[model samples]
Every structure is written in C-alpha cells, then in structure tokens.
Target chain A: MKRNSIIVVLLALVCSLSLVFLSGCATDQTVKSNTIKGDANISTMETAKSKAESVALEEDTLKEAALKAKREQERLMAEAAAFKEKDIHFDFDRYDLTSDARKILGEIASWLSKQNGWEITIQGHCDNRGTGEYNLALGERRAETAKSYLMSLGIAEGRIDTISYGEEMPLDPANNEVAWAKNRRDHFLVVSKK
Target chain B: MRKIIALLIFSVVFWCSSAACGKVYIDINSPAFQKFPLAIPEFKDLGNMKPGENLSAWFADQLSSTLKITGFFKMISQDAFLEDQSRAGITVEEIDFSNWSSIGSDFLVKGGFSYDGKNLAVEFRLFDAIEGKLITGKKYWGKSEDKKAMVLKFADETLLALTGKGGVFDTKIAFVGKEGSSSEIYTINFDGSDPVKVTTYKSLSLSPQWSQDGAKIAFTSYKAGNPDCYVIDVASGTTQKISSFRGLNLPASWSLDGKKILMVLSKDGNEDIYIKHLDSGSLQRLTNDRAIDVSPTWSTDGKKIAFVSNRSGSPQIFVMDSEGKNVRRLTFEGSYNSSPCWSPDGTKIAYEGSSNGCFQIFSVGEDGNNLMQLTFEEGGGESPSWSPDGRYLVFSSKKNDREMVCIINANGSDLRVLPDIKGVKSSHSPSWSQHLNLY
Candidate 1:
C-alpha cells in the first residue's frame, strides 16, 4: 500500500508540469498572432504580456516609415540645391545668351529632363547701372532667353517659368564691375518636385 | 505833397489794371526770373489764449516754409526787419509800409491766430509791400490737427495772388519707399508734412502711379509670389489685382477718364504695351513689337502714348498714337533714355538720360526739338513726374549715398531736395498727384 501511494504522487507531479509547459507554448502563439490581428485576450497574465509585445512591434514599424519619409525629403532638397547652385551670367545691359551660358543651360536642361515632376522658375537679374524700368525689361529678356533655350533642349515649356527682379534684387550689392558681373545673371529656383 | 499823392493814385490804378487783366507777378518760366522777396513776422495772438506751444512763432514758421518750397518766394530775415514785429499790426490799415519797403521785401505775409488748446481760428493777409496795399486775405477755423491744412490753404491763396496760379499745397507725392528687401507705397505732402503708407504688402512694390481723380493708386507688387499689377482705392484701402499675366505686368499710367490703365505685359513672350479696360477687363495690345517695350505714359489729352523701347539697338523714348500707330522716336541724343513723362500741357516729355555713366533729367518737345537737360548733379536724377501746374518736376535723386525726392523747375531751375523723413532709407519713383480738393 505505501508503494502504491508513492507512484500516485509522482504521476500527479508529472501532470502539473506538462500543463505548465503547454500554457507556455500557448502564450507564445498568442503573442505572435496578436501582433498581426492587433488583439490580445487570453489568460490575465498572458494577455498583459502579449499586449506589451505587440505595442513594441507597432512602434518599430512606425519609426521605420518615418525615417524613410524623412530621407526622401532630404534627398529632394539636396537635388534642388544642386540645381540652383549654378547661375548663367550675361553681359552689361544685354540679354543675349553667351556660349558659356548655353553650355550651362544645356546641363540644366538635362537635369530637368531627368526630374520626373519638377518645375523651376528662372529669375532674371540685372546690375544697378541702368534705370530701374529699363533694367526690368532687360531682366525679362534674359529670363525669356533662358526659358527658350531650355525649351529647345526638349524640356517641357510648362516646367519652366520666368521672372525679372530688375535691379531691385541684386546678388551683389556693390557698385563695381566684379559685383555687377555676379549680379547680372539668371538664377534658378525649384518651385515643385515630385 | 499833392504831386506825390497824385503819383500814388496813378500807380494804384496801374497795378489794378494789370491785376484785373490776370497779370502774373512772377513769370516762373523765364530763365532770368527772380525769387520774390517776402517777409513773415511772428504771428500776433488775437485771442490772447494762455501760451502753451508758442504757436505764434510756430504758425509764422509754417507759413514761411510753405511759401519757401514753391521756389517762388524768398523769406526775408526777421533781424533785417525795421519794424517792431512783436507789436506790429497784421492788417494793412494799422502798419507802416516803409519798414518792409526799406528791407527790400516785395511781399509781406502777416498772420493772427487764436488757439484754445484744441480749436484754432486764424487770419492771414498777403500784402504788396511796395504798393502798401493788401493783395489777398483769408480766415480759417479748424481743429489744431488741421493747422497745417489751414496754413497750406492760405499759402495757396497767396500764391494765386502772386503768380495767377495756385500752389501744389494740397497735392501729395506717391513714391516707392524701400526699407530693406521689402518696399511699400508711401505718400507725402508736397510740402513734406504727412508721410502716409499706402501699402503694407510686405513685399516689393514698385512704380506707384496715382489716378487722375486722386481716388486710386496703381502699382506692381510681388505679394502673391508674382509681379502682378494692382490698384488700391485711396479711401477704402481695398486692393484689386487688375493684371495677373503669366509674366511681367507693370503699371505705367492711368487714363484721364479713369476707365483704363496703360501697362507693360510680357505674355506674348516679349514685353509690350497693353491697355486694359476697367469696365470690361478687355485688353488692347498697343504695341506688338519684337523688341522690349516698357514704361508707357499717356498724354494729358489721351491722344498719344509715350513709351521706352529697345528696337533701335538702345532704349529710347517713342511716341505713338493712342491706337498704337504712327510710332515716332522722340529721343535721338542719348544711347539710353527712359522714363518718359508727358508734361501737363502735352507739348513736351520729360525723361532720364544716361550721361557720363550717370543719369540726368531731360525734357524734349513733342516735336522732338529743344532738348534741355534739367539736372546736372553728380549723383544724377531719374523718374521725373510733373506737378499739376506744370511748373515743377519731381524726381528721385541720390545725395551723399542717400536716396531722396527732388524737385526742379521745368526750365531746370530751383533744384531742391525735399526734406527726408525719419527712418526712411530710400525713396524713388515719385508720382505727383493732381490738385486735391481738400479744405
């Protein structure tokens, strides 16, 4: 009779251990599936633990998306900056495009052609030597000349716009020839990008 | 003594006959014209109110300065006066004329005022000091704030009595006042009293053109990220974008009938002159040239338009009929001539011409004769606009690296810079308004 009681107690210990092991597996499954379904409900302790794990996984996903979007915005801004860094200059009181101006405009046209949904505005500027009104019209001619060149290079006309700031907004405010050479030019600005 | 009295009577009759036939005491158009010497003493306190602001001297100074700006009268020194000014009579019947005559004062202005802190009543008398007779007199009742207006009105009457034409005291000069990167439209009195900001666009506003009726101001602004032409009502402060073409919509002038505006537009891939009807919003292309055309100004009679174009290899002034035919180049001397402003009489056009690497103001007859250079300053002059009476031209000039508003007679005499307004760094593109009917 004593031997029979010992065997019965050992069997009871084995059964309780297996039940604990089975619940452990069940909790692991619930955590994985709850991450997908966004619902965690089971035993009280298991529910709480699975909810925490699912919240962490969602946070990771959101952080990854935000990082991707930020990177894209930075890339576009860099591209626009690169496009606007170069300016094509003109002679004093003249708007005809020089050979150097044409070469630079060709490069701009190529870049703009590669850009899928980008648009740019060409700001024509002038030196402060002439009357403001006449310089205004001269600046317009400079911008229009640039626009026509870009269009000739297969860039869509709708992708280009022009404005003449006259002598009002000079890149260099000095009253010398060096500053004037820098002031009278066509400056590019990216208005839109995909 | 009887012979002296007879001579006095004869001279009085002579003066009366000349004045009755509208004889001008000063012929401002003559190249050898002289400034009329005038004397102004401290105003007498007729009301004897408690002294606060010393308005007796203040009113006298205001009247003196107002007359001084017309370039017509010269103020005599008070120290040179032989009379006891403090106790002198303001009327013709009570004073001695020999005191002013000995001082070589051709005219005398005497004022009496009563100020009770807020309201003011003033009396002014302009005298022919040589003849010892009153020429004109005025009495005004107004608030203290209207003191300037009152003084200006009396000065206007005095000018009429002297020149047979009124002064531009009630007129305002609209100009582009630049602070930093931004520019706005501002209006100052012809005498430089009130500086009012007409635009708060916070962007680049240029070339303010006042309408004929003094009710609206048209200009070009980059407010909406584009250079668009807009008109603002002077009374309501309401703005309307009249032209928003794809590129380059600049206002040049307004029609006398207030029904249309002349502007330069570049929608045709080239800058050209265009007229926009205010009622129908329909545009009439005035010039369809391939060259750059800008700065269109209408004649007073509305029969012609003056503009600047580069079709002749350099920018020059050209005149065309109102319908854009009969285009004639008016300037052949300057390689770069622009900013053509038609005179009030429609006989001449004033413009800025480049000379010795600097710009100068010049006026040429409509028939392309008698080219006269108006300004010879080293800093140069530009953007000339005529006064209502056609006696003066207001333009922008630089002095000591500071941009200022300057006035010169049509004959290139009496070049004076208007006093600068505090905190204003630069002012340009002055458009003198028509005579404002204000009391």
Candidate 2:
C-alpha cells in the first residue's frame, strides 16, 4: 500500500507539471485559431464595448452594432464569467502563491492563452505592519511575482502590467491571520487592448 | 605695603571667578548688579616666539572673548598693561600681585606660549593674584592654523571645569547652499561668519547633518544618477556611499548614538525609512506605509523617531519606535508639518508647517502640547536646526525658486536672514554647531 501511495504522489506531480506545460503550449495554438475568428470577434467586441459603456450611454445609431448587440453581450458575459472563479491567493504575509494558488493561476494562464488582446494587470497587496512607505513596495513585488509567473506560462510581457496598492484595498475586512492570508494576494484586473 | 597686598589678593580672587574675556551678556530683566572690574595685560611671551606668531596675544583675546560674551567683565585695555608683547628681558617672570591691588584692578589675565619648530604647544596659567595661588593651568597642541581651534578647545575645557557648562568658540555650522541648478555643502562660524565651501562638485546635494560627535556629515547626492546617501569626513575629505538603492534616497536623520543613519528609499517601489549602519552596510526597513514617508529625526534617547508621513491624506509629523513599531500621529494643527528637528534638550521639536496657507517654522512640545510659531514671513520658512546650547536655530526660507538661510532664537525672537555672501546660491538645510572647547 505504501508503494501504491508513492506512485500516486508521483502521478499527481506529473499531472501538475503537464498541466503547467499544456497551459503554456496552448497559447500558440489559440492565437492561430483566434486569428480565424479575428474579424468577427473585433466587430462583436466593439459592439459589446460600446453598449457596456454605461446604462446612460446614448445610442450611436450603430447599424451593424445594433444587429450584433445581443450576441456581443453574451460573448463578453461568457468571457468575464470564465475568469470570475480564478483567484490568485498567496501564503500568509508572502507574495509567492501556494500550490492551490498555482492551480488557479494555471487556469488563468490557460484562459489568457485562448486570447491575443489580453492586457492583464496584477495588483499586489500585503498585510500591514510598517509605515505606508513599505507596504506599497510589498504590494508591487507581490503583483510582479504573479505577472512574472504568468509570463513564464507563455503570457507575453506586453500583455501584463503590475501595480502595488500596498494594504490600501482589501476584499476581506477581518483583522486576523486568515483575513491577512486572503488579502496578501495578486488580484487580476483585465483591461482589453485598444 | 600690607594694605596694598590684601587688596591685590581680593582682586585676584574676583578675576578668578569672572569672565574669560571683557564682553559680558546681561538680561535686561535681571536685577542690575555692580560688575567686578578687571585688567587684561598683553600676555608676556616667556619662550622664544616665532616670527608672525603671537601666541600670547591670541591667548589674551580668546580669554577676553569668553569672559565678555557671558555678560561680565569690564576688561581693562591691553595698553594699560605694565608690560609689553616683546619678550626682550620682560619682567613677567618677576611679577608681584601687590602692584595690581594698588591700581584698583580687581583681576589680572597673563599667559605665554613656547614653540620648538618641530612641536607647537601652548601653556597658560590662570592666577588668583590676590590669593597668590594659581587657579588653573592648561596646555594645548596643534599646527599654526589649528592653534586657534586648539586654544578654543582648551579654553572651553577650562571654562567647563570652572562653570560646569561648555564653551562656544570651537563649534561649526553645517549648511546647504545651491549653485545654479545644484547644491553644495558648507560650514561656517556659529555667528554666521567665514563661510567655508565643503562640497565643491555640483551634484544637487542638500540636507547636511552632523553626526552626534560632529565628525562626519551625511547628505543626499544624485551624482551617481540616483539619490543615494553619502558621508564625508570633515578633516580627511574622504567620501563613502551609505545607501546605493535604485530610487529615492533622501537621508532624513541620524541615530541618537550616531551609529546608523535613517533615510528614505524606493528600491521596493515605495519610499520608506531605512536605517543604515555606519560600521556595517546592513540596513533595516522601518516603515511600510502605502503613503510617502520621508524626513526622520531621532529622539534624544535613540528609542524613537519623529518623521513626516503623507498617509493621512496630507503630510503630517508622526512618531515611531526605533525598530519601526507603535506608530502614532503627532500633529493635527497644520495641513503639513514636516522637517522635524528635535531640540538638543529633547523637550520640543521645531518643524515647518503650512497651516496658514504658507509654510512657516513652528515648535511644539514632544507630547504634542504648547504649539508655538517661530516664523511667519511673506514667503515661508522650513528646516529648523537647534544650536548646541539650544538657544538659537538656523533655518531656510523660500525666496523665488531658491532659498536663503535664516537664524532665530529658540523662543522665536531675533529673526534675521543671513547675509548674501558671494558664491551663495540657494541656501537651505541648516545644522547648528555644538559648543566648541575654545578656551
């Protein structure tokens, strides 16, 4: 039974390594495949971008956009929904992502691999201790670490931007170790290319 | 003859306890009292004198100045001396105290110097001519140029031994002066005389602060293309780089013990205060604020630091432990309270604040009590440095794009701008001198 457990552990590591490699290898394939749908995607994305501007946005009398508006909305919602579940969390008080964090980030790398116009921003954060001067730096470093890993997974440098907010913004308000662990993370913010 | 000798002993005893020189300082508020008058004789040169060197005269002048500045002494003229400067068989070796008692001279000052071309030394003897016993004897050593500095040191030591307070003749002032687009370091006398340019090369340097012992000065320089901290030996002119970080290196303070310097750096993408050890290049980050933290000044005991931070929507003064713990905001009366310089006595902190829509110098108690305004002009004021005696402060004010140096009393009296000497560009960042051991 111990021998079986050893084989299972090896199998799990191999699966993780393959997942990393596959996520990386799929970018070239996706880009080439994405080119076939480029013209239609641009037109549909433009229509969706305008309608998604705001609820008060006036109608531009976009004859073509009006016709494709409903399908464009569906495409964007599907695209944004695909990334909602991918949260890149980290170990307590550190910027390096955990094993579970790597798994989630691998899914993000795969999602980014399926597109060409992604301009993702990684905002690093930290649990506060010193003066405001230091936390800003810690936040930036955390964000850069995540961006670098994404780049190593075949995400182009030009498509990734990093900024540190230090301990300014937090999704969790509890002032405890668990909350700090959750706050010390790189939250992905996607800005589509012009 | 017995009556004359008794009067002479009384005068000698009076001079022994009075000023080193003729000038004296008296507060108008203090009750007026009769001063003990004294005669200053041209010191007799007992040893072979070098050409162009008057060791006796220098000693006399130094002694006179020390005594005079203290609000005592009605010093008799050097011409009234019963002797001459020429050591040509002078009667100094055969002086009698009874003669001075008859002349109504309450006290007498006399000394001499000896130089063997290879070794320069000064020997002085202070006598209570009335009691007929020597009060104090001092000897000093230095080169011709350092003779004055050494004599001042000796005088200061002797004065402290007598009065229990240090002398002020040997202290120096470290100030920042800009030339064209760049700034340089300079030092001057405590009375703001004889400005000596310390930093000749142009690299936009400012904030010249002395170590606790006044041997080394640390300031920020951009010569290496980024702001980094550098220390310069005042006597040797040797320079050493302290912090070579990637960006934003503004040295803000020195540790109370002068073992480390506190500075701001942006190597980690945020400006934070870092303490750099002088002996070892080891550094410790003290602040992690998401906002800008710059300008750190140490407390007297080295346990805590007062610094400026913009984390509270606007810049304000804050205090933290030496290890960067227990952060607390210290100012709420101003929109901006920065450039905090702690007084030597550690009772108050003089800083620049912009509460009245213009930056002005202000002082507040360390526990955040008794807010006092020190300066208020059309342009504004900043960079307050306390003198060694904690009686005076030197600061800088904005004129146009440049600044000018100004010195004021600790309680905010006698506010005046330093004279615009040649080669003075923009003047800012003043550090006052500690009392020199000038005797």
Candidate 3:
C-alpha cells in the first residue's frame, strides 16, 4: 500500500508543472499585439477630450465680457432719453418765458451736452387770445427766444429747428385761464438720434 | 355843415319832381328812419303774353320784394287799394292819385308786361301818389326768358327816382362758408337770394375780398397745404395764385381801381403788409414793424391804407399813406380792435372792438372822432362790411352760441339776420360787393 502511494504523488507533481508551462507559452504569443494597441488608443482619447474641454471654457469667458459691455451702453442711452419729456410754459398773450421755463431749459441743456448725434425741434404755441395771423408771429418769436436761450448754453444752434403752431395746435383746447396757461408753451420733439 | 347842404339839395330835388309836394315821408338824415307806405298793384299781362305760371304775379312780387329789401318802403297789400287797374290803365291819366292817397300810400308803382314767345316788353311808371303826376316812366325790351332782368331794371329805376341813386339790390356778398371741417368761398345776392359756392378747394379758406369790378375774388386757401393767396374769376372759375410765400398769405384788401392787391405775407419771418400789382406781379412791402401788421384796407380814393397793428402792445387800427408814409394810430381806447373797413364815402371806418369781453361793431370818423357803437347783443359781433351806399352794414354775429350773418342800418337801427341763407349758423367773415348791376 505504501509503494502505490509514493508513485501517485510523483505523477501528480509532473502533471501540474506541464500544464503551467504550456499556458505561459500561449499567453506570450497571442495576447502581446492586442494589449499594446489598446493602451495607445486609450491615451489618444484622453488627450483629445482634455483639449476640447479647454477650448469650451475659453469661449464662455469671452461671451461673458461682451454681454457686460452691451448692458453698460444701454444704461447710458436710457438716461439721455429722459430729457425729452418736459416742456416749457409761457404766460398769457406773452412770448417771454417765465422763471419756470428757464429752470426747465437749464436741465435740458445739461442733459443734451452729454449726448452726441442728437437733434431736436422746438414747436412754439400760443393761447387763443389774439387774431390768428398775429398769434402766428407771436408764437414764432417765442420759439426763437427759446432757441436763443439754448444757444447761450453750450447746445449747438444747427441741431435745433423751430416751428410755430399759433393757436391751432393748443396743448389744452379750453378757453379759460387755467387751460390757456398750459397751452401757451414751447414743446420739444426729438427729430433724430444716433 | 356840408351834410346840411346835401340835404337841402335833396329836398329841392324832391319838391321839384312832384307837382304837389308838402311833407316828405322819409328823412334820409334821421337816425331812425321812417319807412314809406308804398302801393304796388298787380302787373297787367298784355295780349299774347299768355301769363304762364302767374307771370304777372311774379313781376309784381319781384318788384315788391326788391323795394322792401331797401328797408325804406313798407309794401301796402293789394287788398288795401281803393281801385283795381289793368294794363290799359297804367297811364298817368288813368291813375287817380286820390285813390292811392286814401290808402296812406306816399308812392305808387304801376307796371305791365307782354311776352310774345321770344320777346318781352315791360312798361313801368313811378308816381308821387298825392301829387296826381307821373315822376318817371321807363320801357324795357328783352328776351322772354329774361323777365327777371327786366324786373330788376325797373326796380333800379324806381329807386333812382326816389333816392337819386340806384339801389344795391343788384349787389352780392362773398363770405366764408364752412363745409365739413374746411371752409369755402361763397357768393350770395344782396338779399341772400342765390348762394353760389365759388371754391371747391375742400380746404381751409378765408378773407374772400371781391375785386372792385366784382369780376373776381381774392382769398386765402390751404389747398396746397399752405395759406396762400389766390384770385379766382367769378365767371369761369379759373384760379391763379398771387402769393405763395412759404408762410401766411392772407388777403387784406383790393385797391379801388382793381389794379393792386394788398395782402399780409409772413415770408420774411414776420408779418408785414404787401401790395402786389395784378398786371406785373410786382410786390411792394409796406410795413416793417417787428410787431404784427395785418388786414389792410384801402380808402375810397386809394390814397391811404388802414391796417391792424400791435405795435402799441395791443392790436389797434393804424392809417398810413399809400406809400407807407405818415403812419398814424387811429385807436386809443381799446386793447383789441381789428377788421377796419373804410366807408365808401371816405368819411368813416367801421371795425370790431371788444367791450367787457363782448366784441361789437363800432364806427369812428376818419379823423378818430364820433365813435359810434353799431351793435349790442348777446354773444359778439365781428367782421363788419359796409354797403356800397354807406347806408347799411353787414357783419357776422355770434349769438346763442351760433354764428350768424347780420345786417344793420348804418345808424344802428333795423338790425336783422340776413335772410335766405342756409346754414348761416356758422358763417363768418362777410365781404360785401360793389353794385354788380349784372342785369
């Protein structure tokens, strides 16, 4: 029984060694080319992905700066637009400006100084107190007086135009004193802006 | 003193024209005139006239209406006549003055008409009813279709016999009539008989001043979108622009000889009066005041021009020589006065002045004395136009919130709304024409 056991152990050791050696040889010949090609493809894919990410980040930064500049310009334009909303008033049967008119005109002059490439038209009006023909002339004088005042300021004369509406286009169509006060005025209209 | 001499001459002529003159029915110089009671019998239709459509009645009706328009005669009805006369009895021998005198008629008119298909013959006689004598007689021959002309001629002759001057019943009035939102130029007879639209511009028009000969009208219109002055021939409706100077081109007055037109032009950036010669198109600037000067009117002799100016801080009447020399302000009392029209006789100027915020018509002597108020009523009166005879004034009146054309006697009596105009409720800026005498 002892002699049979020794022989079996030797046979087992020999079979194990033969199997290990055969498997090692097969791995060396067939798996060598595929593993190196696979490693090269993975490294090239990683470099291309990193370069694309870097270009996308740089474009986002430039877009952000351009948006900031456009927003600033719009804010300045909105401020200059506010000066066109007010009108100058006059007294009854008179083309001379009241104190209130001069105050309003000064504000307009300051705002116009900051704006470039802007032109305005000044329309002179009158209350229904005199003859139509005479009122026309009176209204013209009123507009010219206003233009002269603007010229005394830094505003350019060529940027202003004048027209007289007489009593035809009244701001207030009533014949009473309160309405006439409102109707006798110099109205401003923006003709062009760049 | 000169007026008294004129009355004396009129009285002598009146007494010499009639055989038995005693008292005058109407005193021409009186402030409030007394209307004469005048009798007009039916016009007799002679043979072959056929009297179609009551032709005889039409003739008598026209004559009576024309006489009443003068505002000097009160027509006595036919029912009040003492005797009925036929065409054969139109002679002096057949008319018995006592018959008319009994009816309180100071004057009588008898006429006859015969129309023979193509031609018409009309005979009329004016008589001083209490004198038993014929003052004047006339015979007219015209086409049968021209019966209206014959009737108007006879009426003119009757007025000439009584007043030593023909009536203005043949005259016309040109005014601004509103159509929709725009105003147009219109012409109507003196008694408001026929209203004819002279302009179809369908735009704002104003200040329609008739030429002295009544052949054309000068007005301002906005057809070309500017207040431009235009002259239109009344007969042919042909229009020609006289002034289109980039601004207000308002007509002020036409010269008495029809040789020139004075207008207000604002082309030089200010209002100034300008005279434009019709034949040569030459323009002359008359005033250079920096203040407003407008609405120029010429005197009877055409040697002077009166205009409205605000040089004294308010609009007032100013008179200057024809060449713009010798400038004199004529009004000192009012803060506002406009529309100064010189009287045809060169003795007075009628204008509109505001009193207590009510505009009324006033007349002042040429030398700025004898200021007389011609109208007083609710609303206000403006644009006073004088008759050619200087006996009546027609103006625009605003009463009851409606605009109306009114005619008042020069003495401020007999104020009445001009009759037969449609939609006169909004009419303004009346301009009376010279005696047309179209017939």
Candidate 4:
C-alpha cells in the first residue's frame, strides 16, 4: 500500500511541472535588476551634465560683461584725451610748421607718446582763393608739415599718416577773411595700422 | 552872368547829343537806330597789297559781318561810292555824310590804315547820319593781327556809341561740339577764328559760364563719374571741383559781386538752387520748392534770379528774388523754355523757347512784355547768350550739312554762322566772355 501511494504523488508532481512548462510561465531576476541599475545610472549622468553646462554658461556671461566694461572705460579715456584744445594752422600757400602750429602739435606729440600701438592720420585743408589744383598741393604740403613736426618731436615716423582735403572740405564757407582763417587748418584722426 | 549860365544849362538838357566838349557823344537810343543804313564805302586798300592779303578788304568783310549781324544796320551797296587806295588812308576827305543820307543811309563807317614801319596805325571814324558830325573816333597801333583786333574794337566802339554798350565782337565764346559720344569744349573768337579746344576730357561736360572777373570758368564735368561743377582757371589750366556733392551739380550765373557760387544741387533729394560760399564751403539753401527748379540765372543788377521749373506740369520760366523770396512766373507762353541769360544792359532776358515741338530763340522784356520770337524753322536753337552790347545773340543751331554756331540779331534778322573750322559739326553753350582786352 505504501509503494502505491508514493507512486501517485510522484505522478501528480510531474503533471504540475508539465502544465507550467506548457503555459510558458517564468520570472527573470537578473533582467529586472539590470534595468533598475541602468535607469539609476542614466538619471545621475544627465543631472551632472546639466549642472556643468549651466555653470559654464554663467561664467561665459560674466566674462563678456567684464570685457564690455573695460572697453567702455577705454573709449571714455580716448575721448577725454581728444577733448583738450587743439589749434593747428598754416601759412599762405605753405605747409611749413609755424611756431604757433608746432606748439599745438607739441601737445599732440606728448599725448601720442603715452599710447603705444596707436596710429594716426593728419588731414590738411586750405582756403578758397586759389585754383583747386594749387589748393590741393598746398593742403598736401600742410599735412606733411604737421606729420614731420610730430616726427621731429620724437614720435615714430610709421605711427602717423597724412592726407589733404584741399578747398572742397572747408570748415567755413564765408567769403570774408574770418572764414578763410578758420578754413585753413589741419585736423587729426586716429587709425589702426596693418 | 547867372542868367546866362542858367540858359546854358537849359540848352544842355534840351539838346543832349548836340552838347559837345573836347569829345562829341552820339545818342545811344537814337530813334532811327532800327539799323542806321550805314554805308561802309568799300574800305580802300593802300598800295601794292599782296594777293589774298588785302587786309582792308578783310577788314570790310569783318566789319560788315559785325554790323549786319547786329540787326542794326543795312550795309547799303558800296557800288554807289568810289574806291581809291593811294589817298585812302588820309582822305576821309571824300566821304560826304550828306551824300550817304541822300542815299538813304543813316550813318557812315570809314576806315584808314597807315603802316609806319614798327607799327601799323589804323584810324576809324563813325558819323551821325542826321546830325552831320563825327560821333566818335579811335586809333589803334599794333601788328596785322592787332589791326584786325583794332577793327573789331572800333566796331564795338561804334556799336557802343550807338547803343551805349560794348559790342561782343571782341569777346571770346566757349562751346561744346559732340561728335558721336566724344565731346570737347572749344573757345572761338567771336568771329569764330580760333575754334580751339579748352577741355579734352574724353567725357561729357556742359553748362560753362565765365566768372564775374573773367579770370576763371565754372562748368559741369562728368570726368569724375557723375556731373559736378568744376572751376578752371582761365590762364593757368588748373582744375578744381567746387561743387562735387553726392549728386548732380551744375553752374548758374556767378554772383555779381564774385563772392558765392549760385548753382543747382540735387543732394538735398530734389534739385534746388544753393548759394555756396566759395571760401567757407557753407551752403545756404535758396529755394525750397519741391518742383525741379534748375537753370538759375541772376539778373544783371543782382537783385533777382530766373530759372526753369515744371511745377505746373509744363516747363516755364520763373523769376524770384535772389534770396528766394516772392517768386513769380515769367513765361505764360510755350511749354519748354530754359537756359535764361540776362542781357548785359539789363533790358531783356534771352531764353530758348519750344513751341509746336520745335525750339527757337526768344527774348522778353524784364516786365514780361514785348515777347518776340527771334528764330524760325526746325532743328532749333539752345542756350542763347547775349553779346556784350545786347544787340546780337550767340546760340547753337544746325545750318547746312552739320550743326554750327550761329549769331542771330535780337530782332531776328541776318542770321550768320560763326567760322566752324572748315564748317564741321562743331560748336554749342557759347558763354561770351566779359569784354576782355581793355588793357
């Protein structure tokens, strides 16, 4: 009787095993644990990347503002330098530097001496009594005179360029003497060298 | 004694032409001046003149052309008078002004030339046809070429005595003749002898006017890309652009005082007249009209200006104060009238008039009355400038096979063509010089 009972239990256990296999029921512990680990690693990496990017952007904006402020300060300084009184003049049909003109040019020479890497242009003008060609020649002479004067005062020769405007770009249009006096002048402009 | 002096002053006022001192003056506005039928007695030649070198005959041709083109005199045929050479220089001895008057002439022009080694002295005398007296006389001492110049000056003097202003015969005129696309500015003797090139820019140039002092010429040149007003020194050949604005710049008349340049500028969006200070380069806007106001010419006295505008949809002449105040319309006739030039005497203004699709030279009084058409037919005239004496006008026109420079009398009589250097398609704008050679 004991042997028959043991045999019936064994068969029942076999039937249950077959039925579970046929239904394809199984649980994967390694896959579920691997998915959970994968999700945690991805979120942690994304958070770190966003924090680094935000810090870099903030640093870039701070650097940009500091550069702009420095540039504004330099512009204001240049304006103050140019604002001092300057009176460049010429003789009749001559570009030769007079004592008075050189005195005014002396101030420019000292100012230019302070700043390195600054290139400048000297523009000459003339009155309207003579022919246009003659006035142009005269203007060129005047500009060169100023340029040479600046060079004589120990300024580097390559630092200054000269140009002539002739009578066309007059500072005054009056036909009287006062207007002509104002028209015959040389002005300066700042430029960058190549 | 006081009564006698008062009577003398009264007679002086009553008979002005008859009033004589060491010099006798003729009435400039003499009523009979419609053309004093002057008899230029076949100018007598002095002995042994070389063939084709009959200087006096050349003088007669020049003088006849000068007077006849003036619309003032009919050169009565010289066939009625005798020609003698041996006694001609000293023998004005035979000219009977009464005989000329009897021949239906109102004046007499006679010339005598004497060569005394170093210089040839030519003397000329103009006679009053009715007053029966020598109105004025002059003597010139120079070379053969100088003698021609002398004769022209004498013609001018005669015209001046008759009209109270210098003749344009001695003045120089500048014009542009374009053959194909190439153009050049040429200056010719009023009789058109030396049609010499003033500018050979190889580009377009136009609107030339002499400076008030006659030392420089202001014109528009395209040599620098666009049209800009350039002033060239007459003697030095130096060029300078006075009005090289960003847009079109053209010369009008120079101010009478020789201080400012009155020209047209389109820099302010539309073309307007601007008075540019020559020295200070200051520009003062003169007119604010939205219409295209161009071709500004100052009045002779410098009080007003006249220019062309299309504000009414058709081009007409308008006059305004020099400061651009109180503008008024001057031409109610014709659709296209432009390039107005005031007479030197300030009596009339000459402009090219277009009507029925053709252009003609027309003159109108400053009062806008007496509008007379001074040209006829087709291929019309442009840029009519008055001779210094206001008797003749120089304008560009087509004659024969090509376009040539023609001088028409203000009365529209005796249209004569200036010498066009073998009669080629040459000449136009002809800004007459302001009476040079006074020195």
Span of 10 residues, lowest total lDDT, candidate 2 chain B: B1-10
- Show the colliding residue pairs in model 3: none
Worst 10 residues of 1 chain B by lDDT: B1-10
Off by over 4 Å in 2: A1-194, B1-147, B154-163, B189-196, B278-280, B355-358, B376-380, B398-402, B413-422, B433-439
Candidate 4 - CAPRI tier? incorrect
- Which residue pairs collide, candidate 4? A172-B280, A173-B280, A173-B281, A173-B282, B35-B72
Score candidate 1 by lDDT: 0.85
Q: Model 4, range A1-194, lDDT digits (tens) per residue?
A: 99999989888878878766654444345567778899899988988998889888878887787788678658745753472335487755456677888787887788678765566777768975433323443565577778778889889978987655555456665455677788788888754345
- Give a tens-digit lDDT track for model 2, residues A60-127: 44644775765765675477556644567765335666787777667778877876666686767675
Best by lDDT: 1
Measured by TM-score, how close is model 2 to the native structure?
Answer: 0.53
DockQ of each: 0.35, 0.01, 0.12, 0.01
Q: Which one is best on DockQ?
A: 1
**Candidate 1 Cα outliers beyond 4 Å, as residue runs:** A1-79, A191-194, B1-21, B50-53, B115-119, B399-402
> What lDDT tens digits, residue by residue, belong to model 1 across residues B269-303?
88999999999999999999999899999999999
Error of 4 at B100 (Å): 5.2
Candidate 3 has an lDDT of 0.77
Question: Please, what are the lDDT tens digits per residue for candidate 2 over residues B1-439?
Answer: 0011111011232233334542232332133543335555656665666887766666678767655543334566766655433532223345676656556555555555667775565555555556544445555554556555555554554444344454555677788776765668898776455688877777667668788777788887767755567899876889988877765566667775778898877777666888988788888999997776878888877788999887886668998888999999989986667778888888888888875456788898889998988887765777788877666678877665456788765666556677675877567678775543332
lDDT by residue for model 1 (A1-194), tens: 99899988888778877777788788889877886565333465587778888888778777877787678657876877776788899998799999999998888888778875788889999987666778888998999999999999998888888999998887766666788899999998875554
Which lDDT value does model 4 have at B13?
A: 15
TM-score per prediction, in order, is 0.84, 0.53, 0.74, 0.60
Clashing residue pairs in all predictions, respectively, total: 0, 33, 0, 5
DockQ measured for candidate 2: 0.01
